[model samples]
Target: MKLTVKEERCSGCNVCRVVCALHNAGAVQPSQALLKIKGEFPDPGTYKIAYCNQCGICADSCPEDAILERDGEYNIDYELCTQCLICIDSCPFDVMVVTESEYPAKCTGCGKCVELCPRQAVLADQG
Candidate 1:
């Protein structure tokens, strides 16, 4: 499973980001969410969403082999990670979230964001 975004339906609200942060970091900090919401430049009403497709790019980029794939879902193994921040810079989608105080994280296909999105903007695709 993977999370997909409907940019047209998004209201520029960041419930997805907040939920991601809570799941990944035990906080409400949207800045640490595994997904990214970007507002259109020079515009306030439009937004773009970037979410992990469970791609293994970060795992491949990890010099320490800390990023791992389990049952097709990818996540960082904190103990093996060295906080190199290389995954953050290597994400092709630019959605990888690696804060100084937190370990890197990726979507675990929990679908919390899809269940709670007020606009139904987040979808869980079984593909």
Candidate 2:
């Protein structure tokens, strides 16, 4: 499964970020969210959503074998994680984040971001 974005439908409301941070990290911090929105106002005037595509580059790059796939979803096994940033660097979209807790944060394909998008700009499905 992959999370797809419809940039044109995004209103910059940031609901997806809020939901992601709250659902995954139990906080309201956008910086800790797995996905990010990048753009500026009154110039290009477009918001670009960046998120995991479940490409497995992170899993393949992990020397500790911390990342694993289960039931078609990629997840990190925190006990096996060595706080290495290899997965973070391997992410093509730069969506993987290293939290203040020293754990790497990647999408679990939970669909929280997609479900909370007010504009329906984010979608998760078998791609």
RMSD each, Å: 2.1, 1.5
Reference-based lDDT, each prediction: 0.82, 0.87
lDDT of 1 by residue, 34-123 (tens): 777788867666888888888899899999999888878887888999888889888899887766575676677778889888998889
Tens-digit lDDT track for model 2 on 22-83?
Answer: 88889989888888887768898998988887888899999999999887678999999999
Worst 10 residues of 1 by lDDT: 98-107
Candidate 2: Cα lDDT at 2: 68
lDDT, residue 16, candidate 1: 83
* Top-scoring candidate (lDDT): 2
Q: What TM-score would every model get versus the actual structure?
A: 0.85, 0.91
Q: How good is model 1 by TM-score?
A: 0.85
Misplaced by over 4 Å in model 1 are 41-45, 100-102
- lDDT of residue 75 for candidate 2: 97
